[model samples]
Target chain A: MIRMNKFIKLAIATCIIFSHSSNLYARDKLDIKGFLTIAGYHSSNDNLGFQPHLSSSDVGYKGDDEYLTLSKVGLQLNYQLSTQFELVGQIVAQKEVVVDNSDRIKIATLNYSPTSSLLFRIGRFAPRTYLLSDSRLIGYSNNEVIPNHDFYAQLPLSYVNGADLTYNFGLSDGVGTASIFTGRTEVNINATDGNTLNSKFKNLLGFNLEYQTNNWLYRFGYTQSQLANSWEQVDTAIQFLTLVSQDYPSPLVSWTEGKEFVEAYRVKDKWFRYKTLAVQYDNSIWRVRAEIGDLAADSSNIPKNKNAYVSFSRTFDQFTPFLTLSAIKTSSPRTFSKPDEGLVQFLSAQSNQNLAFGLQQVFQFAETSAYNQKSISLGVRYDFALRQDIKLQFERKHVEAIGSNLWVVKDFSKIKDEYVSLIMFSYDRVF
Target chain B: MNIRILIGLICFVFSSVASAEILVIVNKNNPISSMSKQEIIYIYTGRLMAFSNGEQAQPIDLYDGSQEKATFYKITTGKRLSQINSYWAKLSFTGRLKPPLALETQQAAVEYVVNNANAIAYIDEKYLTDDVKVVFRLDS
Candidate 1:
C-alpha cells in the first residue's frame, strides 16, 4: 500500500514538473490560478471545537480564542497539452484546529476529452457529492463565508483516488450532466485520547446527476462504500474487556467471555451509503437554495443521520445579505440491551450490576459517533473589489444530545442543551 | 416646485439611468449573425466555449466594476456581478473553464473583438462600430 501511494505521488510530481517546463518554453497553454481565504471566528464557549464537517474534524475555532484555523490558500495549475488531453493539479495549505498546519495536494488528475460532450479523469479528484464540492475550499466561490455546517458536517471523505467519467446531454430545454466515479481513500480518525487511527474505505462508488436551465438548477447524488475496520483502539479495548471477563465464574455469566460474542460486538466491515438532493434558483436579484441528505451505515457502531438546509439571499448593488436555517438528526443502532435472562439469573447481584455497567459504557461510546444539531446563520457580503469580497456572519447553534456532547472539544460536563453563538469575519479573493 | 412636477422629474432621472443598453458583438467575419438570449448566456458563462460550427469562441469583458459589464450579465444571465464572479472563481480552480478575458476599457474589448474572428464581447450600445457585428442586445 505504501509503495502504491509513493508511486502515485511520484507520477504526479513528474507530470507537474514536465508540464511546467513545457509551459515555460511554449507559454499561454499553461494556466496558473489561485485563491486565498482569511477567516477568524470567536465562539461563546471555550474549547468549542465545532467541526463544520466530518472530513474537517481538525478545522473550526478552538476554544473562545479568535483563530485563523479556517483560513486557507490554494493554487491550481492547468496544462492543456492539447484539445483532447490536459493535466490539472491543485494544492492547498491550511491550519487545522488542534492539529498541525499542513500543505496537501487536493487534486492531480490527467484528463481526456474525446469530444466536447464527454470527459474522463484518472487520479485524485474531489468527489462531486455536493453542489460546491470542487470549490468548497475556495471561500471566494461561495456566497456565504462558510457553508451550512449541519448539512455538510456528516460527510467523512472529501476526495477519492480513482477514475471518473462525465457525460453532458441536452434535456428538453436544459442541460443535463451525469457523472460516475469509483475509488478508494484512507481516512484519519482522531480519538478523544489524542490518538489518530487510519481507516480505509474500499469499493467507493458514486454517481451524480444534474440538470440546469436558465434560472434553475437541480442535482441528485448517491454514493456507497465499504468501510474496513482497522482502528487499533477498538482491538485494544476488546482485549481489556476479555481480560476483565476472566474474573467471572462461568461463560454465560461473564460479559465478553465468549470469543464469538466478542467478535459480534467488534467493529466490522460495514457498508456506508449517502444520498442527497439539491435545488437552486437565481434571478439576479434573489437567490434561493435547499438541500436534503441522508447518511447511513450498516453497522450498529456507526450512526445514521439526516440533514437539511435552506438558504436565501438578495443582491443589492455590491452587497448581498443571506440567511440560512440548517439542521441534522442522528440515530444510532447501538441501543442499550440487557444481558440474557439465563445469564442474569445465574450471576450474583454484584456481577450482574457490573455487567450492565460495562454494556452501558460500550454502547455509549458507539452512540457518541453522531450529533444532533440545528443552527440559523445570518451574514452579509460586500463586494469591495473585483473578484474579491468580505463577509461577516453570526450563527446561533443548538446542540441536543444525551450522554455525550458531540460538538464540544473538551469539558463535556459543561455542555448541555445550550445555544452557542459564533461570530465570524472573512475576506476572500481570487487571482 | 409643484409635487406632481417633482415626482415626474425623479421618475425621468431613474428611467434614464435604468435604460442603459448593452450590445453584444462578434467579429464581422464570423459566420454567426445573431444569437438567442439563452445562447448568449451559455457563451458568457463558459458553458459553450465553441460556436455551432465548431470554431473556438473567446468571450471578452470590460473591466470588473464597469456598469456595462454588470448590466450585461444581469440582463443576459440573470446573475449579479458577484454571482458571476463566484461562478467563474469556482470553475477557474477546477480547470473546467475560464472566465472571459477582461480588457481595461470598452474600446479595448471592441478592438479585440474586431481583430479576432472567434472573439465575442459586450459594450455599451453607444460604442457600436462597423468593425464588429452586433449579435445580441440587453437593456438594463
Candidate 2:
C-alpha cells in the first residue's frame, strides 16, 4: 500500500510538471477545462436519513438545515504529446455524506489512439458500469441533477487501476463500440459501529457493447469481480458475539470459532456480478431513456437486487421538464442462519437459553442489509444562460423492508413502509 | 387606412421572404456535392469525425451566442444552443472530443471552409459564393 501511494503521488507530480512545462513551451498542445455543480436539498421528514447514492453515507436531515452534500468542483487537464498520445488528469473536491470533505484525483490516464477507431487507456479510469459512468460526476453534462440513484447506487466501485481497450466500427449508418476492461479497486466502507471496512475487489473483468445512430443509442454491459472481506469488520462482529455469549454457563464458543463461522457464512471472499441494459432516444425536442440493472452476489449475506428506471423529457425553448420512475427490489430469500440444533439443544440442557436467542439476533441483523425501494421524480431544467443551467427537482420515495429495514438510519424505529419527499436545487456550469 | 394596412401586410411578407437561410458549405474542391440532414447532424455532433472517403473532417462553428449559430443548430439538429453545449460538455470532458472550432463571424467560417477542403461549415445563404459549395440548406 505504501508503494502504491508513492507511485500515485509520483504520477500526479509528473503530470502536473509536464502540464506546466507544456503550457509554457508547447502552449497549443495543452487544453484546460472544468465543471462545477452547486446543489442543496431539503427533505420533508427531518428524521429521514437520505443517502445520495449507495457509496455515500446517509446525510441526516434535522431541524431546518438543508444539506449541501451534493456540491462538487472539478478541473481537468489534457496534454497532447502527439497525434496518437495524450495525458489526461482530473481532480475533484466534494463534500461526502459521511466524510465531511474530500479532494482526490478522480482520473489520471495516458491515452493512445493510433486511429480514430481504436484507443487504449492506462492508469485509473472510471468503471464503465453504466451509460453515463464516465461523466456521472459532471452534472453539466446531464439533464438531471444526478443519474437515477436506484440504478446507479448499486455500483460499489467508482474507478479501477488498470487498462481498457475500445474499438469503434461503423455499421451501416450507425457506429458500434466494443470495450473490454480489467482492473482492481479497494473500497472503504464505514460500518455502523464506527469501524471502517476495507473491501478489496480483485480480478475485475468487464465488457460493454454499444450502438449509436443519429438519434438513438443502445448499450449492454456486464462485470464480474471477487471481493475479499475486511478482517476488521469480521473481528468486530466476532468480538461482539463473544461478549454476548460470555454469560452462557456451558462451553462458550471461542473467538476463533466464531470468526470461522462468520467468515463461512458472511465475510469470506465472494463473487459479485453486475449486468445492465439501457436505451435512449433523443431528437433535441423529446428525450426518452430506460435502463435496467441486476446486481448479485453468491453469498447469502449479500442481497441480490434488481433495479430499473424510465425517464421522459421534452424541451421547450430553454426549459426542459422531465419525469422519471425508478424501482429497486431485492429477491434474496429471507432465511436466517439457524443456530446449530445441537448447540441449541446443549444450551437448553444447560439452561443457557438466552445464548441461543443472542445467536439468532446476529443472523437477523445481517438480513436487514437488503433494500426495497421505489421512487418517482419530477424535475425542470432551465438554461438561464450560455453554458449554465439551473434545475429544480422533487422526488417522492417509498421504502419498505419486507424482512428488515435497510434504508433507515441508526434508528429504524422512526420510519418504516413510509413515503418521504426530497426537494433539490442545483446550479451547474461548464467553464 | 385600408391602403396603409395593405402596404404594411405586403412589407411583412417581403421581409419574411428575405430572411436569411442557413447553408452547409464545403470547399468546391471536395467531391461530395450534397449531404443528408442526418449526415450533417452526425458531423456537427462529433459522431462522425471523418468524411465518407475516410479523410479527416473538421467542422467549424460561429462564435458562441451568435443568433445565426443558434438558429443553424436549432434547425439542423433540433436542439437549442444550451442543450448542444451540455451535450458537448459530456463528450469533451470524457473522450476529449472538443467542440467545433468557433470563429468570430460567419464570414470567418466561410473563409475557413473555403481554404480547407477537409473543413465543413454553415453560414447564411447570402454568404454563398463561387469559392464554396452549398451541400445542404435550411430555410429560415
Candidate 3:
C-alpha cells in the first residue's frame, strides 16, 4: 500500500520533528498540538440531494439551479504521539462532500492512543456517521440542518478501506461517557449494467455504534454492498435513469423477434440494511437536533426507505443562526431490475414502451427519483477570528424542494419546485 | 469610636492596603493557600483533570486561535466560542481528549509551568516579577 503509506509518512515526520521542539525541552514531555479545518459548500445536487449516481440517493435534491463547483476541500492534522500515543488526520481534495472539504483532501489516518480509554485507526477514514457523520468536519461542530444521525446519508459514504475501535467508559454529569464501537470496511466496485449498459463489480460491508455525553448522542449502523453504478465519481445518474427507461418506440408484436431482451442490468447479492436514531443538545445556549431512519432491501425491492431531519440553533458572538426541516421517504426502495429471461427481445420491446411512456406522463415533466421529498433550509454563519490559528466562515443557503429526482422523461412523478441558493466561504488552519 | 469612627477606619485600611492584589501562586516550593474561580475553571478546562488538591493538573492552551484565547477562555472557562467549539467538536469526534499546549505569554505560561511537575499556569499580575506564584485572580 504505497510502502505502508511511506512508513506512515515517515512516522508522521518523525512525530512532528520529535514533538515540536521536544516539548519545549522535555521534562517528562506531554506535548500536543491542534487545528485544521478546510471547508466549502455549493449544493444544487451531488451529495446532499442525491445524484452522485444514486444508490437510492439522499439529501432530497431534484436539481435545477446549479453553479459553484468543487463544494469541498479538507485537512486536519493533529499530533500528540505520546503520553500513550496520538496522530490523527483528516485530509481531503474532494472524494464527495464532507470529509474535510474546501476543495478536498478527505481523511489521512494513523491513530493508536492505547489508553485514555483506548483507540486505534488505519488509513483513509470518515466512517462513524450519525450525530452528523460524527462531528461532520468540526467547523465548530454543529448548528444543525444536516446531522440527524447520518449513516452516511444511508450507508457507505467514505472509505478506501478502513478500521476503527474506540472505547470510553463510566463517567457522568448526567449520563455521559460510556461509548463503544466496532468497524470494518472492504471496498472496490464499478457499475454500468442498468440493463446492459456495461461495466460491473461489487463488494462492500460496514458497521458502527456510538454514544456520547456532556450533552447527548447515540447511534447504530450497518452497511452491505453489490455496487457498480460506475462506483460513483460524479453523476451519470443511473446512466440517466436507464436512458429515460429505454427510450420507447414499439407498436405491438415482432418486437425485434421476441427471443429475450437486454440492454443493461446487475444486482446480484445486492443488499442494503440500516437503522438509526439520533439526538444532540449541547449546552451554553440553544441548539437542538433530531433524526430517525430505517431502510431494507433485498434482490430488488425499492419499497422500505425512511428518513428524517430537524434543527434549531441560535448563537451570536461568532455567529450561528440556523433552521432546517428535511425528509425522504422512498418506500419499497430497491431498484434495478431485469430478468424475465434476457438476451434481446428487441430491447425489451423498445424498453417497455419507454417505461409506458414514462409511467403515464405523471402530471407532466418533473421527477427523476420521485418519492416523498422535502426541504427547508435557512442559514447564516460568521465565525471569524481569522488568525490566532485561523477561522473565517461565511454561509448562506436557501433551498426548497418538495419532490424531485424521478422524471421518467417528464412523465413526472416529481421534480420541479426549487429555489436554491448557496454561498459557503471558509479558511481553516491547523498545524 | 469617636471622631466619625476614626475617619471610617482610616478609609478602610487605606483601600484594603491599596486594592488588595492577592497574588499567591504556588509550586515554587509548594505551600498552597488560595485558588478558586471554580478551582481555576477546573484546571483550565480539561474538565477538572484533578487538583482541588488531588494534584494531576497540566492544562495549558493559547494556540488554537487567540486574543490570549478570548482573554484566556473568558477569564477561565465561562466558555463561549460556541462552548469552546462544541467542546472541541465533541472532544475530537469522540476519540476523547485533546485541547491544550499553546504558549505565548503569561511569561510563556509561567516559564512553561515553573519548569514542570504537574505543571500549571497563569500570569500578568504585572508579570509577577520574581519567577512565578499567583494561583488565581482572573476577574472580568
Per-prediction TM-score? 0.80, 0.83, 0.32
What DockQ does each candidate score versus the true complex, computed on alpha carbons?
Answer: 0.32, 0.39, 0.12
Kindly give the stretch of ten consecutive residues in candidate 3 chain A with the minimal lDDT sum. A188-197
lDDT of 1 by residue, A1-431 (tens): 01223333443444344432211122347777777776667767554566554444353343544434566666788888886899988887664422223227778889998766678999988888777777778888887777787877556465688999988765676778899999987666544333565668899999999998988999999998887665675675566455444435555655443444355455647688999999999887898999999988775555688889999999888899999999888865544344454554444363444544555566566656566878899999998776678899999988764422235456555555667788888878776
User: Which digits, one per residue and each the tens of the lDDT, describe model 1 over residues B7-26?
Assistant: 99999999877666788899
Candidate 2 colliding pairs: none
* Model 1: colliding residue pairs: A47-A63, A53-A153
lDDT of 2 by residue, A1-431 (tens): 01223333443444344432211122336777777777667766644566566455435454333434566766788888897898988877665432222226767889998776677999887888778888888887887887786777656465778889988777888978899989987765544333345677888899999999878999999998888654554555555454433334446442335434454445546788999999999988999999998988876556788889999999998899999999888886545334445555565566545655556666765666666889999999998877778899999888774522323354556545667788888878776
lDDT of 3 by residue, B11-127 (tens): 998876455342324456444556766555544544445455565556665444445456556555545644575566445543345555667666677677677655666544555
State which candidate, 1 or 3, has the greater lDDT: 1
Model 3 docking grade? incorrect
lDDT of 3 at A416: 47
How far is each candidate from the true structure, as Cα RMSD in Å? 7.8, 7.3, 19.0
Comparing candidate 2 with candidate 3, which one achieves the higher TM-score? Answer: 2
Of the true interface contacts, what fraction does each candidate have?
0.47, 0.52, 0.22
